[model samples]
Structures are given as structure tokens and as C-alpha cells.
Target: MKIPRVVVGMSGGVDSSVSAFLLKKRGFDVIGLHMVNWDAQEEGTSQCPRSKDESDAKSVCDRLKIPFYTVNFVKQYWNDVFLRFLENYKMGRTTVPDIDCNRSIKFDIFHKIAQEKFGADFIATGHYATTSFGDFQQNRNDSQEIRLYSCADPLKDQTFFLCTVSQEQLKRAIFPLGSLQKTEVKRIAEKEGFHAVATKPESMGICFVGKRKRFAEFLDEYIEPKPGKIVLSNGKTVGNHKGVHHFTIGKRINGQYLEERSHLGYFVSRIDAENGDVVACEGSHHPDLYATRFRIQSPDWIPIRNPLEELPDSEILCRIQRTHPPVPCTVEKCETSRFLSVIPRIPLRATAPGQMCVFYTTKNECLGGGEIVEIQDTLV
Candidate 1:
């Protein structure tokens, strides 16, 4: 019998290092593949982060006695993920680029390269997610539809970023760290003498931002500034903004041009791109900052069939942010098949266009999600 060959995406991080170690210990043939998604030159940084990452990944592979290789997806990432990210910011909408990077690059392009080039039987990652097929795909069934589930560590659950992944992609996915907590992963790495990985701080937010002075400043290099007015709900102009791109819904406004003064600082309630007006509301908990109902573009359901069609008007749970616990929501078909209407049992704050509304079953299964294209009704 041929031992299954599994290719693991090693980022020199503790989680991935442990993933490869576990797979190899299980008697499967393991290979380490590192992806270079961003070019350091583009950011004008003297130190290239990818160089250190590649070195660390290779070191892990050497320690494990496995082969290691690096693949460059810099171009693909720039086109598929980064460009779309800039477009969203330019349009004054907050977007998550990590979702697109997972869907288009890691699972899609990486899968193709793994199979076509390396003859990999399966590909694995350190993502804190699990599937119905099991974390290691030990119980994979070709006929049965696979479902994504939140990892054991709810705080680190990445199902939100993976909501866009298709069924086919989930089929071959292996998440070794799904059942383990971050502390446990680090402990395992430490025991194995992988101290560098175990002690390395986890990277957060957008990867390409990389040691930038400020997020807004990093964005300014690419986006041309368009001055806009900050106003109240009653059409009262309160302040001026360099651009709508710098602000996200529900985030507090910081500027000197505000003519209106309140004990509670102003927060963005809306971004009117056409009129160049960023609507603001006093207080973080202002009614205008919350939305109970919204319309989303058609969802990319993980299951083979759309659940809404299977059970019309069924209760579901949804969340916009990965860290937030899923809230109960009801779904309805819009007049046009292109959209779906969602109403959460509780009001959702900072719901904005370009943000993904990830849905989950009552049992915590990730049912997939759709990008929120419109916010139909607010708490006003």
C-alpha cells in the first residue's frame, strides 16, 4: 500500500510546524510548501519578511526530515486579492482581503499546484478550522457533502475567513490544529525543540501592511485622496475628512474640523460616496450605527445545495466579524434571485458593504456566506 503524500503549507509558525510534525508522526509522507504571497520591494522595506519566513519554513522541514519548497504567488495575490482590496477602500467600503486570499490563492491555486506538480494526495494548513470529514480528513466520503465547522478554539475560529471556500476546496483541506488550542500548539512546538516558532508572535490583520507606520498612511501610497464632508443625520456638516477611504462604519472620527461638539465623540454611520459625504452620529451606541436588516449578494453555500431553498424561512445564525459569536438570523429570498435578505434577532453594529455575512447552523457548522451589498434598515 502506498503511503498518502500530504503537502502542508508551512509558514514557519508554531501552528504549521506542529501540523507537519503531527502528519509525519502519523506515518504519512509529508512535504512542506511555503508560499510567497507579497513582495517586500513593493512596500519599500529593507528587510524582506518572506526571506525570514522561507528560511524558517525550510528549517522546520529539515528538522522534520522532510522536503521543502517555496512557491511565489506574488502576482496572483496582487491581481486577485490586493487589487480588489484597494477597489473596496477607494469606494469607501471596508473589506477583508484574507477571505479572498484563502478562496483564490491558498485553496484554489495552491491546490492545483500541489496536485498537478507534486502529486499530493491531500493538502493541509494550520488554519484553526475543521470539517465534517474530520480534521485530518480521516473519514472523508466522496458522496457525502462536506461541511465546515468552527474549530475547538472559538476565540481563534477562522471559519469566517474561510466562508468563501467552495465544497470542492473543503474536500481536500486538512486542518491539523483544529482540535488544539493555541497554548497547546505552542507547547507541542516547544517540546519538539522548535522554540523559534513557538515564541514567534502571531501575525494579525492584513499581511501586506507589514511594519508600516500606520494603516491609513500605507493606504495613502496607493489611493488618491478625495476630500469629503462629515455631516450629521439632519444634514448638518460637522467636520471635514481627507477621504472616505480612511474611515469605516462605526469607527470614531478623529479630526480638528468638527464644528459640532458632544460629550461623546462622533462615529461614522454611513459613507455616501456619490455626494462625498460621510454621515456621522454621536456616541458609539447611537441607533444609526446599528442595523437589524440587510441585503446581501447571493451566498456561496458550502453545502452542495442552498439551505434557504431546502428550508425556506428557517432560523440561522450569522456574524460579520470572525471573533464575534454568531447571532440568530432569519433569511428571506429577495424579489431578485441575485440578493438575499437577512435580519438578525439582535442589531448588528458597523455592518458595512463589502463585509462578508458568514452564516452558521445552530450546531456551529459553517453554512457559508455572502458579501453584504446593502444595509436595508438601521436602528433609527
Candidate 2:
């Protein structure tokens, strides 16, 4: 029987270079593949040009003696990911495009294309994740099962983003860099003599579909900045804001314009978009971003009825976003719907809507997560 072929998603990055190299060393027929999320002509800039990244990826494939392929996923990305992102920001919600990109483009689009077009038996990425199986088989049933594990490098672990994968997809997805530290992976890549290994800086922040522009720039084009009053919590006016969309809860703003402000420091507490208002709360101290409990939405179903069903009530502990680790708490399922009332472990700051609040245990098992329900205008 022929060994199954694996197509590693190589983005001209060190991690992916290492991924393809390691798979080849393991005796699997491996190839490097790149996906073009945006066409350079669309943005009039080629910072992340499709042709360039593919060329770079192909160079590594040649050195590694492997086949390479390029796929155009631009339209799907704009419709499925970028459009959703724009809609979210319009509603005063901060969006995580990377998570959406992972769900719709990477796992869904890449996996399907690898299997059908590339004839790839398996798909791999340099994502900091794992392809563990026995971890899910404890139910005493299926012989073949796949469970995603945390990467050894806590700083780089992306399991939080992969939380949405279905059981079937999870089984097919492989993450070779999960168990190894980032340093070790870099060492392996250098030893393998792969080009672009040392200078492959990790991409961070938003996934703008290769649009090299700031959110303000994008939003300015699509959204009109309505002027609003920045009022203190005591109903005193401090200064004016360009728009409510420009500000968000928890962000501290300078109060140099305040005529007689005590601390002369202020922070965002509310964004009244409907009335074109951005309210600022004045104080000496800032609100803690940490919360003991928070409601999560867009939950990834865990095959069982729902993990939250295993909870004492419908409520569970949660961490509002990627900034902090998860903590313990319980919830009161809102009187009428999927909404949950989070009684946090402690009083914390700015649990903004549209931001994810992932749940985990003090024991560190990710109990799945969801986007935060709206936070309040008043400071706790």
C-alpha cells in the first residue's frame, strides 16, 4: 500500500517550513501548499501578495524536494470572514477575524481542497495544537477519534481558536508543532536548511484578508464618524469624541480637555451609538478587566448534548477573552433565552460584547467558550 500523502499549509513561515520538513523526515509523502486570501490588485498593495507567498513557499518545497500547490480562496474569505467582521464592528462589537479565518477558511476550505483537488490524505498546519486521539475514546466506543491538545508553548498555543472544529475535522487535522516549544521548532527548521526559516516572524493581531490597513482606515471608508459628547459618570462633560465607533469600553482616554477634572484621567464606560454618544467615566483608579464569570455564546458543541449541560446549572466559569486565563464561577441562564448572567469570580472591567469569553477550569480543561454577552454601562 502507498503511504498517504500530506499537504502542509506552508505560508512561507518558519513554523510551516518545519512542518513540511518534519513530515518528510517521517517518511510520509509531504508537500507544501499556500492559500491566497486576498488578491494584491484588490488592495493595490502586495504586502502579502498571493504570487509572492506562493513563490516563497515553492522555493522551500524545491529545497525540501516536495511538490507544491497554490489555491485561490479570496472570494470565500471576503464573504465568509471579512464581511462578518465588518458587520460585527458596525454593531459596536470587537471581532476576532483570526478565529473566523481558522473556522471558515483554514479548517473548512483548506481541508476540503486538500482532500479533493490536491489528493492529500491528510492536511497539516504549523498551528500550535495537537492531534491526540485516546483522549476522546474514554467513552468506550469509537476506535478512531481525534482531540485537540494545548501546545507546549503556552505563549503560542492556538487551541483556543481551534475550539470550533467538528469531531470529524479534528480527526483529519494534524498539528506537528504542538508538542514542541517554539524555540525547538526554530532549531529544527534551521538544522533542516529550509529557506526563510530564521526570519519568519509570527503574524499577530487582526486578519484583514491581507489588507494592509488599520481598522480605523477600513471603518472610516464604510462607516461615518458621528460626533458625540464624552461625558463623565457624574453627567459632567469633558470633551468631544470623533465617533462612538472609534472608542470601546475599558479603554482609558486622556482628559486634558476637562476644565476642572480632579484626576484628569478618564476611561470609556459606554458607547451610545444610537444617540451618537461616547460616555467616559472619570476616576483615579481603573476598572479591572478580569471577571469571575461571564456569559459565552457561539459555543462549539462537544458531541455530548452540550458541555454546559454538565454544569451545576446552565452557568459555568469563564474568561472574557485571550488576555487572561480562565477562572471559576457560575451563571444564571437569562430568564428567557441563551443569555447567561455571569457572577464573576471577582469584579472586573469592560466585558465588551462581540468579544469571546472562553470557559476553562482551575484544572485547565477548556470547557469550550462563547462570545461575551453585552457588558453594562455602569462601572462595578
Candidate 3:
């Protein structure tokens, strides 16, 4: 009888560190695999930020008496994840790169390497999501269908970012932090002598931005600035912008050329990428900033079946961003099968093309999601 081997994607973060430790305690032959998705040298940085992360990951693996290895996915990441992200921004759309990274690199390439190269039975991560296998993965059956579920902690649940993962990928995936809360994970890390990891601050926003103070400045390096008019919905030109790409829907309009004439700050309502026009609304709570209906590309359901076809009567919840709570939505078939129209019970704010609209059941099961293709109707 051989012990099942599992490769954990140790990211030097507390959540993943605790995941590797919990798996080892559960009797799996664990190995730590660190992925380098970016090369600092390409950005003209002398000191590679990943170097410290690699060292920390190695330290955790060494303390746990497990084999540690590092793989560079910089090329793959730039091609698959970063390129798509930049393309979306250039088109005046807000996209989630982490979702792309998971779809392309972490689950796809990392899974292949873990199983083919390491000869492992399973691959695990620190994601705060679970599957039909149950929390801690105690229940298992080869014939059973796998459905992604929200973690124990809703605030930390990461199922939104993982909606694109296929059934095959979710089948062999292990999430040790699924049943635990953020505070609990930190406590466990500290108890296990991972002081550095336990005390490390959480990583937020886009990873490629690093510690840059201005995100617009970072984007300017890649996208050429094309000055454009910032107009109100009523054809009132209140300001000018460096580029339409510099603004995102629902964000407050800010720049030197803008006239702050409104008592309420002006917020972006739309980006007309074709004409380089950025439309603004008067307030954060402006009706123009709230969307009630949108069209999305065909969804990638977890069980490989379109939920609209399988369970038409089932209640579906839609979420545009991870932080936003899932709201009741009605999915209607469009004229062409390539897209679907979604009408939420409550209007969603700041939704734009290129954002992923993840679906969920009332029971908290993630039904997968698709990229938002168009905003059909606003509250106004």
C-alpha cells in the first residue's frame, strides 16, 4: 500500500502555509511547489520580490520536512494572464487577472506539472473554497460529480475567482483552508511555528502592480496615452482624460483637467472605447452607475451542463465581484447561443464589460460563471 502524494502550491502566504501543514498532518505525502509567475527584471527592478517569497516558502517546506521546488511560469503568465488583462484594460474594460491566472496557470499548467512531473495523486492550494467532496475532503467518490462550494467564511470565500475551473481540475483539487476562517488559519500558522507567515499582511489588488502608488501610472507604461473627452450623460463635457483606459466604470473621476463643479463627486458611468469617450454621472449613488441587466458570454458551468438547460427552475444568484454578495438573478436565453441575458433582482453597481459574472445556487454551490459582454440596462 502506498501513501497518496499531494503537491501543495506554497505561496509563502499564511493561508497556503497552513494548508501544507494541515495536509501533512492528515497523512498525505506532501511536497511544496512554488510558482514564479512574474520576473522583476522585466520591469527593471534589481531586487526580485519573488526571491523573498521563494525563501519563505522553502523555509516552511523545510520546517515541515517536505521536498520543495520552484517553477517559473513567467512566460506562460505573461502570455496567458497578463496579456489578456492588458488587452481588457486597453479596451476600457475591467478584468480580473487572478481568475485568468487560476484558469491558465495554477490549475492548468500547475496540475500537469504536479501529476506528470511529480507523479502526485493530487494537487492542493490555499484557496478558501470547497467542493462536493465536503470540507476537509472526508467524503470522496470517483463517480460523484464535483460542485464548488463557498468556504466556511463567507468574507474569505474565493469560489468567485475559481468559477472557471473545470470539473476535471476541481476533481483532484484539495482545499485545506475551506473549513477554516482567516483568523483560525493565522492562529494555526502561529501555533505551528510559522511566525513570519502568520504575521505577514494579506496580499490585495493586482499582483503585477507591486507597491506602485498610482495604478494609472503603471498602466501608462504599457498603454499609449490617447487623450479623450470626459462627458456627462447629458452631453455636458466636464473634463478631459489622458485615455479612456485610465478610467473604470463606477470609479470617481479624478485628474487635473476635470472640473469638480458638482457638490457630489462625478463617477464614471460608461466608457465609449470606440470614440474614446468616458461618460460620468453626478454621484456615487447615481442611477446611471447601477446596472439591472447585462449580457454575458456563454457560462462554463461546473458539471459541464448549462444550468439554464439542466435546472431551469432552480434559483440562481449572480455576483460580479468577489466582495459583492450574490443576488437573485434571472438568466434568459439570448437570440444566439453565444450569449445570455442576466437580470438581477437588485441592481449591481460599477459593472462593466470584461468582468466575470459568477453564478451560485441558494445552497451556496458555485455554478460557474462567464465574462460580462454587455451592460444591457441601467437603473435609470
Per-candidate local distance difference test: 0.90, 0.68, 0.90
Give the runs in model 3 whose Cα sits over 4 Å from its true position: 44-48, 312-314
Candidate 3, residues 24-73, lDDT tens digits: the string is 99999999999999988765432336777888999999999999999899
Q: Least accurate stretch of 10 residues (summed lDDT) in model 3?
A: 41-50
The parts of candidate 2 lying over 4 Å away from their true place are 42-51, 134-145, 209-214, 254-264, 283-285, 288-293, 303-305, 311-317, 376-379
Candidate 2: C-alpha lDDT: 0.68
Cα RMSD (Å) per model?
1.4, 3.7, 1.4
Q: Which stretches of candidate 1 lie over 4 Å from their true place?
A: 45-48, 311-315
Q: Write the residue-wise lDDT of candidate 1 on 136-164 in tens digits.
A: 88989999999899999988989999998
Error of 1 at 158 (Å): 0.6
| Per-prediction TM-score to the true structure, in the order listed | 0.97, 0.86, 0.97
Between candidates 2 and 3, the lDDT winner: 3
Q: Please give, for residues 1-380, the per-residue lDDT of candidate 2 as tens digits.
A: 99878889988778888888878877888978888886566554415545656777888889988988788899999899878877776666776777788889998989999999888877888888664542112222347444455667878877677666777677666677877898898888778776465566666666443455654664666567677787765677778866666666777664543444556467776666677666676553444333445555547753435666665633445666566655566666666566666676556567777776666544344555567766632234
Model 2 lDDT at residue 55: 75
lDDT of 3 at 252: 88
